[model samples]
Target: MPEHDDAKADAKATGAVTPQGSGRASKRPARSAPAFGAFVRKEPVRAPVRENTQANTPVGASTAQADGLRVETAQSWPADAVEVGAVIEAYGLKGALKIAPHAQGGKALLAARRWWLLKGREQPERHSAVRASAKVHGDSIVGQLAGLTDRDTALLLRGARVYVSRADFPAPEADEYYWVDLIGLDVANEAGVELGKVADLIDNGAQSVLRIEYPETGKDGKPTTGERLIPFVGVFVKTVDLAAKRIVVDWEADY
Candidate 1:
């Protein structure tokens, strides 16, 4: 794995190769990237102005109808909008089931009114849809799906995945972002030099880090790429704007 400093040096030494996202690069005159280490100001990523969806709308609003339940085809949901949590088997006879969220921010699960369940298998298939309401149960969450009303019914939900809409989530505080919000954004240094797209976020217990993928060309138009991991600390990351789908960092093109 390359470090941020190594990436900067590679970019500067190479010159004006294809910008990072182009998935191609060629030897060319090196351009001096912007000085991003100086400006520490934060900026909003500006969400597109749109009329707010109706407040009366239910959670998983697109799936709902006049009958108070909605069915969502797997194809209809945006990949970024779904969250995965595990159902830890039946809690009791009342159709309630134990849930373990995939993240510490799991409390967001209880805050939403409805969830989509898909059972896990050797190869999980999306089937047997259910609508449910959730509430916090000690350190975990417990919820009742409309069709599950007994231990036997709940047992069927064991190891099921819980999918909730991003819209159902509460607004994050300033300087904070949900991991999903940051996953696909373009990252750049203050100097406006492109780094790479955010490939994944890793939680190393103490803090989160972003994995960035950098593309390189090899004579031919085909590109090869490498990855670098950067800590998501205030010192490294200056601003994150999900609306703009970009992350501005305090790093240097040659860092």
Candidate 2:
């Protein structure tokens, strides 16, 4: 992160405003619009699977069940290789299953040609015995695993999670970042003063704000107190260096 001196120099060179004092203030003002293509908010629907469900339940669990579904576990890739999506319910006797993806983009699930199906883990030996795979069908996706040739077979897979590796997805463009990448980056002001780590990104329908976990430090190098919120807008953000894992802002320490 750039220090206070560096920030002051940059502001002077660029003719931008610099906040005085600790910059801590009563409240932060509203931010302006965002630049095109910038990831201002996290995906609203998709998230990690929760624990404490039925024993052996798949990672990405769902309740939409039809008939002809089959379940089994995968073994070829590491845990992170595939993220879990909703399970397949039988579509019809011909052996089709309905799939609900976690993200709006189904590219990750579509790219992975194979899948391991498992029933809940209560019967690990039996769950491990099943195997299945799928293929992309135009906009929607379809899967056909071993022994799942009929509606009855497909119905058996209901509630099973669909997993795919992070590598299966395409890379993001410059200035555009995935919500997962920004979650823990350190946030600081242009003056090189420490603020806080990004606790999370909150969406307010209009825009997103960074929930900073403020640090407790005074001029005496002692802990002061309190936290703050900073809008992740281009006007306030000077630069975001993903490689360095830091965000330099035009904000002041006070407010």
Question: What is candidate 2's lDDT per residue for 78-189, written digit by digit as tens?
Answer: 4654433555455556666555544333434444445434445564311211225544333234555444556644554566556554554445444444444577898888
TM accuracy, model 2 = 0.50
lDDT of 1 by residue, 1-255 (tens): 111112233322111111211111356543343221110111212223334343112223333332233445568654645554677657777767677765542444655556766544463434333446664554455666665566654554455567767776555434556666677789999889999888877666545667888788767778888677876766567677778999987566554
What C-alpha lDDT values do all the predictions have?
0.55, 0.49
Error of 2 at 48 (Å): 20
RMSD after Cα superposition, model 1: 16.3
lDDT of candidate model 2 versus the reference: 0.49
Stretches off by above 4 angstroms in model 2 are: 1-84, 88-97, 111-149, 203-209, 214-233
CA-only RMSD, every prediction: 16.3, 13.4
Per TM-score, the best of the predicted structures is 1
lDDT minimum window of 10 residues, candidate 1: 35-44
